[model samples]
Target: MTSKIKGLKHIIYDLSRINEWWLISAGFVLFAFLPYTFMHHGRVLDIEMFRILFTDPAVYIALLIVFSAQIFLFASNDYFDRDVDALDPGKRVRNPVCDGRVTLAGVRALLIVTAIIPLIASLYFGLLAFLFSALAMFIFYYYTAPPLRFKNKVFLDVLSHGLFVNTFPYFFCLVALMDFTVGTVFLLFAIMMRSTMAQMLQEIRDYHIDSQVEKNTVVVLGQKRAIWVVFSVYIVLFTVTTCLMLSYELFGWGIPMYYSIILILAISYIPIFRKLLKAKDYNREIERLWMGQGRTNRWQVAQYFASFSIYFILVIFLIITGYS
Candidate 1:
């Protein structure tokens, strides 16, 4: 039993390293999932819903489905990117798959195991949940794998992510709650805008390695152009969320929460820009700041998520208190 436990611990450690936990946190895990989970419970807090989420087997199953989907997606990407990861001289090469800490076959097995969980969970959740999971899985697979690797493509890469990564998860939660309505459309678009910002920033940060690997992104538009892309996307996102907050005057919290999100975005990137302006190697500095594995990454990451996290917490509080 002790040997079994040790083996399992080793396996979990390996998975954690390869999972790219930082990317998951920055990508869709934090901002998108939390808000949507709360929104599903009538866009306000309900103790019963919270209880159900914790104590109910179905809720656990749904959560497992989403978690497994993310694992499968990341694991597959790890497998596919191992070569490029090996090529990357930066700390990005710490990837278990690239560093020989885990084998390709091991990752493949992990992906297959995780893939099954979502399928089983989907069966339990009903057709809508099943459809959302399936579509997300398909897009995620094609996003990194294949003759049609969307991640290597420009517009399709970000657009597919906007749909699968950001939108599908929210829809899955809505299905679990059985609360599909017109207002949800606005919420979906709002989430899409935020997701796009994350995706564009990621692409921009990875410009050097990705360009060497011949992966096309807005980076193909060049560094200055890519920076502009990020800035413009944020502006549009800020504008849209402001409009959304105003449109949904939910007891006066919406405006402040959205403004807080904008503030966080501004705070997070401004320092990076200021540094970039004075840096000898602007791209390298930007990459370090954005990726957050280096010495200064934490400051950037904390600033980036500060206002967003607060907004999320505020929403959760409002929901729990039954505030509109």
Candidate 2:
């Protein structure tokens, strides 16, 4: 009983990356279901329609698959990066394997179980979604695993992270809700660009220690150039998203009138835009972003909320303002 209790504790403990995994969960819900709401917007005539969205069996299945993906992402990363993680006080304390809260074989078993759940849940969607989930599972598994470890490779590091971390999940959800089209492809491109920026920024944040052992893309390019890469990717993402919004508006893609609010919010990031692109001292700015406990952290939180709140608030608004 005691051993089993400890095992359960470690499994639950390692999955406690709520600040992160929850964001991915939100992304899954928005990307998977938003198109459904838009296409069937007229169905919002009743509060029960909105309630049905939450109560639908598919939502639970997608949540199961996404949560499994997150478990694989964090656990595999921690299992493989245990040595590198031990170098950072923050990561070291949070890592179950490094902290001796989870065993190597136990993590392996956990990974197996997590993968199985996604495989089972995705089949309910369709063959295409199942395939998407499979590829996502493969990417998440091999991302930090040996031999084909995409996380340690130059360029491929960010590319693979871009695919599975964000693009794949969104695409997987897209497969379930809508017929794949050119518009969906464009959206995938925007997501991939944003994911690349995020992965590189994380690498930049860990440059101090990652440089020692993890020869990732950022380590190869060096932190200065890596930040530039992040900035450049952000520009591409911003441009693509702007174009997407424009297309939706012009082509009558069924987006709401308030969608312009999202563009305005994106514009609001101009201050950080100048901070990253026009900063006189990159080192100090990066340090404050990752290490400082002041405005930097608050800035990140603001960015997070700004980027995501539109989808979140829209979900509620759609539910309430249903043509009902």
If scored against the real structure, what TM-score would every candidate get? 0.76, 0.81
Estimate, for each residue in 43-110, the C-alpha lDDT of model 1 and write its tens digit.
54467656644665655565566667777776777777777777676644556677765667777778
- Per-residue lDDT of model 2, residues 197-239, tens digit only: 7688778777778888868898889877887878777667667
Q: Cα lDDT of model 1 overall?
A: 0.64
Clash count, predicted structure 2: 1
How well does candidate 1 match the true structure in TM-score terms?
0.76
Which ranges in model 1 have alpha carbons more than 4 Å from their true place?
A: 1-11, 14-49, 166-168, 178-187, 249-282, 294-296, 304-323
| Candidate 1: pairs in clash | 45-319
Cand. 2 TM to true fold: 0.81
Which is the leading candidate under TM-score?
2
